[model samples]
Target: MFVDSRRREGAAAFRHIFHVQMDGATSDRESPLMKYNYVALILGVLLILLVVLGNILVCVSVLTERSLQTATNYFIISMSAADLLLALLVLPLFAYSEFLGGKWTLGMTLCDALMTMDVMLCTASIFNLCAISVDRCIAVLVPLKYNQNQFSSRQLGLIAATWVLSLGVASPVIFGMNQVADRDLSTCKLEDDRFVVYSSVCSFFVPCPIMLLLYFWMFWGLRRRRSRTPLKDPCHRRSFCSTLVLALCHAKSLTDSVSDGEARTQRREGQRNRPKTVMRSRKASRVSRRERKAMKVLPVVVGAFLACWTPFFVVHVTKVFCGWCTVSPTLISVVTWLGYVNSAVNPVIYTAFNTAFRNVFHKILSRWM
Candidate 1:
């Protein structure tokens, strides 16, 4: 009987040990999840800060520097403002939701507001980029007529229209047209397929194609210019030969004392002005080189925009169209954050491409330092 009792005790002990082991395993799984949550929280905060600061710097630099206050840079300023709005109004809420494991504690009205702002600001940003591409294309293709004054008013009108259109795209939510009424209150998303399609087309599909076409035309113009450059070399050589012959004739006249007194004075004056003319030509060439470099950097901006936003938009469209396809929440979060990262990247691209922005940024930084 005692042996049987001892055996029962051992069995109970084994069961207790098994329970303890299972608990430990569960805790082990949870620890990594908790660690991940902490990491995500930290990263999200940093991203918000980065986006805010970078865009603010861009706006301030443009506003303060007269050189950057041109018509082309007004589009850039608008882009920065859109990004700043996104970082301020959208990102904090997103970060909070992310930290809470995608559960939005914010109310439904705020949820709708957040989603509206998200769609509106992002759409505006993309449209601003499209405007920039169009502006650059015109500047390259029609240099003589690309006056900033002629475009300034039109650009302002276009920027205003861009926001109006963005608001129109996002207006359905405010009117209760496309809402996920029965969706989980813990999560806020545009669940209506029609609204998704509309928003996607307005924000990405239409604008992306237009941007691509403008860039293609711009590059085609550039290639034509480059190919014709060699042809211009022969004309330049002929002009040089003509100028040399004229100079030789003038020298012969001077040597033969066939030139009048007034002519000798005129020749001396021309010799004195030649160095100044060469200096002006060299300065103009340098300016042209800088403009070309800026032009080259623009494609990089467009390419970066495409790369950063494509995956998010692709997954978004797929989710809307494929009802049965399941996507992990983590994946959605990653792609959403990826899109936000573009806001941070933009000012960096501006600083890299445009020397004026870089100089203004340095001046701003120096004041603080």
Candidate 2:
């Protein structure tokens, strides 16, 4: 009886251990969080690929194309470089952070460093755009004063200053102001919501509003001196040019018809010798009309800048006020990716308004291929 009882006890213990192992396996196999993380990983990788390719193309085209090597082009190159840095440094880590499904695995120090880079590089790009706007505004307002030679050194100095100031502002956040993984939950980021808010405010809020005000003033000044100013809306400039070309063609046809009629009448009166002189005089008048139709596209670009960046500002404001408004991880990812996508669109915007850039791009591409 004792032996039988011991055998039953051993068999029951073995059965319990087998059941526990099955349960552990089931838990490991069916985790929803793991599935979601896999999705985030795939999506993040795709977006990073797009950003890398697009920014690299912009940089390469600017460097290779002679027409794009101007001071303005250099600023554009700076902007593109910043964007590429963000994609390389910030986006991949962000994706990995998400892969942990909001759980940070890379500890705190690295996280703080990445957060600092994101803030600093992003600020540098914003200030760069603002500088471009100011330079373009100045160029349009005082064409003779903005000699490319004189403007180049000043622009270079300002670009350097932009980098120095960005680093200065961002250093505190990375150095010790921010919590490290060694101290807190082993994750790096702008842990203080208040600090994030302040940083964004100082970087985007203050500078962006000032930029808008300056742009508005520039537009007003342009309008006030309308008679002396050439066309500045790059988009409008193209439309105006096309219209002028058609109008000139129509006028030339009309003048030719009138001249032919006059010559016919003169021939009937035995004086058919003045058509060449009359046609030459009309051609000179047409040439003068064409020369008066040059247009500048800086204002159009200002409008585009406002449109592209306004949504981000609005989203930031909504987040500030509605602190409890839970945004989906997916939506956050989309908005953040869209913000990065801005770098991709800028070259296209320049091509749309600036004929010289377009022609240069075409020549470089053709030659390379």
Q: Which candidate tops TM-score?
A: 1
Candidate 2 lDDT over residue span 35-126, tens digit each: 55887689778867766766676688778776566666677787778878888998889888777776677867787788799888878878
192-274 in candidate 1: lDDT tens per residue?
A: 77888888998999999999998888778766765665554433334434544554456556745555765667566555564
The TM-score obtained by model 1 is 0.76
Candidate 2 structure, TM-score to reference? 0.69
Taken over the whole model, the C-alpha lDDT of each candidate is 0.79, 0.66
- Estimate the overall C-alpha local distance difference test score of candidate 2: 0.66
Clashes of 2: 4
Q: Against the hidden reference, what TM-scores do the models get?
A: 0.76, 0.69
Clashing residue pairs in all predictions, respectively, total 0, 4
lDDT of 1: 0.79
